[model samples]
Target: MSGIELKQLSEKVFYLPGTVNAAIVLNEEREAILLDTGSDKDHGRRLKKACDNLGVKPVVIVNTHSHADHYGGNDYLTRNFDLPVYAPPLEAGIIQNPVLEPIYLFSGAKPLPELMSKWLLAKPSRVDHILEPGALELFGVALEIIDSSGHAHRHYSVKIADVLVAADAVFGINILQKYPLPFGQDIGGQIASAERMADVGAQVILPGHGEASEDIAGLVKANIAVFEKAAKTIVGACTGVAATTVLKRSCEILGITIKDLPRYYLNHCTVMAYLSYLRESGHVELALQDNELRWSAAGN
Candidate 1:
């Protein structure tokens, strides 16, 4: 980095490595406050290099969520810097234990090498300060922290100026391929979070992965509708069919073969977890009959 670090958005916001992004705020004497480390220790090293070049100390370090890919470098950051790492209180368990970031076991997306890479990168660390979903006051920035807790209750998306760091609140379906910019979420909390963003009326949106966009409120709302409709359909099917049948139907509807998807049944695990969440929330009900899991919307 040059003597002056580059800002990605209007001002005071910069892109960190991987799926990570951060906001820089100037404190009383004018020091920078950093937010969110990327997927690995390399990102922390890069941030330190940028700090060394900039001749300033970052007064704060905050995580946007507890996802491994989002805050895996916290160990490196905490060890090297004297700043406090703030995260949502609900995320403290997983951030502290790391085993709670369990998506890795099912993603089926990352191969063993990639998994090992993530495992090596994911060293546990403690949160020095707790954060809730609310506006935060720092040196020079008034951060509007919204409880965008659908992707994870452990998540918060920050808003500054006209930009909202959407952070998986809305994303493209095949985000990793870097194409298909549809919102990839179909869950209750995710729907509500997108609606919140729509209501906020930000001109620009930044997703957890992939590119940023200008004016996506309508799309976010549309994706929310998709979630509701899909949820209803899933719950309905559960009433009459086995889990495997539902999974097969879902695969057909989504236009992919099980063999072609991530080997670990990531696609299946996602639905299973979503169903589990819905069942626990009283939105859906399930029973094991004939040696197969069956489901239905409550009272249906």
Candidate 2:
């Protein structure tokens, strides 16, 4: 949390940049509404300090999703302040039972101890509110909750004061360059969400992992391009190939090396997302042969 500064985007909105970008929106009553907490307890403390320095109190925390990097500080924040935590539908369950993140990532099997790091699992915190996609008024601030699912199940973006807190609906351009195939559970939904972001009509777009930008159109296009390219690579690799084979070959095409369980599973899930997207779009189909399931281009 060293060297981090609270930057004010608007009179009502402030942000702290760290591993993840968290925003603070001041309501009419002078209380603060935290957009998302950062990656751990220390982040929560730092956020608290920032609020104190700004002369505001945080009365509520609205998590954009259940990913540990976005909500890991919830435990500390909730325990320290009398704040209500709000999370999206399916994500709320995972936030309150952090172990579920690793469990589901491991396909519902017991995850390896190494897979349960703080990056993937955070301490559990109670969810005081379950948010749905719609208009919400909290602490005198009006917010439009947009459905931005796919990066994570039931993920959401928040719109207020001309800034869109776009959770994981899209990644920063640098993050896209680093992980060519971004983690997504449903590629179709992810693409749709990116398109939705383009139509958000906000003056500024703040992604979960990147600096805020006013070029919402450019950002949306970049995000869609990444998804489209990954889909193409996966589809091209699917010439009667097993899912695992497609995953491996796609990683090779993207120059991504999976050296650890976390990286391996994340990329594996991403490839699965592409496969699902291809199948749903009628570009690919699945078949079983020799006791193994394989994917092939549709009508092949």
Candidate 3:
């Protein structure tokens, strides 16, 4: 397949691969269900074209999570087709009110200009359905919604036939290598989700941001390793260090550079996630002293 072209995943399922992979599932009537729209309207346009080229009419959209990139193309697709959108509960709130993304990222304050970019805030789109985990039937296709939260609150992955649209529960190996400290709101949950994928029993697994693979165990292990390594780095840095300093030191040790406000805030959020997870796991502790919140190794 060429750029943004469709690749077959199964008899009824196909995918358009780009920076973010969008899955296309077809019903007997040739109506399509889009698993995710890409980063913006252009991606939406391209996805629509790709489906058109396949001779399928997109009838529904399911956002695997609330992250902008996962649902950014929602507005364009919905506007053009008036399709019903489905997403998990908590994620649905953010997808409709995208400002919540930047708000929460800035610690519930008004976000700065840089934080308000499309990378963090996509245009608002309507969600017609709130998907719950377990068996679901969409346009005659049977699917199982698996709970894959942690990367984003209440995130989900879809399983159609023997193909599992794993979403971000487990990223592709290339993505894992590119981003040493993968983004997660709950490191422990992220690790658990990756582990869960090992037994999901899918013949083919499609990660939201990487190549699809048949090696479920290998993908699971690679993803879990990244989270565990990040946790270890954060715990090692937590020697009476403030959250910001911990993020800096951990990134430094990981050979990552926070080049801009967006990346800084993103890495900062992930670092805080690791700290929260480590503290709960009893590897680290949080304290308030001199009007500053700091962290250190447990029992320090």
Best by lDDT: 3
Q: lDDT value for candidate 2?
A: 0.89
User: Per-residue lDDT of 1-300 in model 2, one digit per residue for the tens?
Assistant: 232489877778889887799999998777999999999999999898888888889999999999899998899999988689999998999999999988988989999998899989999989999998999999899999999998997999999968888978988887888878989998888999999998978898888887788888998899999889999899889999899999999889989889999888888888888898899999999999999999998898
**Candidate 3 — worst ten consecutive residues by lDDT sum?**
1-10
Model 1 per-residue lDDT tens digits across residues 136-195: 886667888888877666578888768787776766333533321122223567777878
Candidate that scores best on TM-score: 3
In candidate 1, what residue range of length 10 has the lowest lDDT sum? 177-186
Residue 108, model 2, lDDT? 95
Ranking by lDDT: 3, 2, 1
Candidates in order: C-alpha RMSD to true structure: 4.7, 1.8, 1.3
Candidate 2: worst 10 consecutive residues by lDDT? 1-10
Cα lDDT of model 3 by residue, 19-75, tens digit: 899899999998999999988999999889988787889999999999999899999
TM-score winner, 1 or 3: 3
Off by over 4 Å in 3: 1-4
Name the candidate, 1 or 2, with the larger lDDT value. Answer: 2
Off by over 4 Å in 1: 1-7, 22-30, 51-56, 103-121, 172-186, 225-239, 242-245, 256-266, 276-285, 296-300
Candidate 3 backbone clash number: 0
TM-score each candidate: 0.77, 0.96, 0.98
Residue 17 C-alpha lDDT in model 1: 31
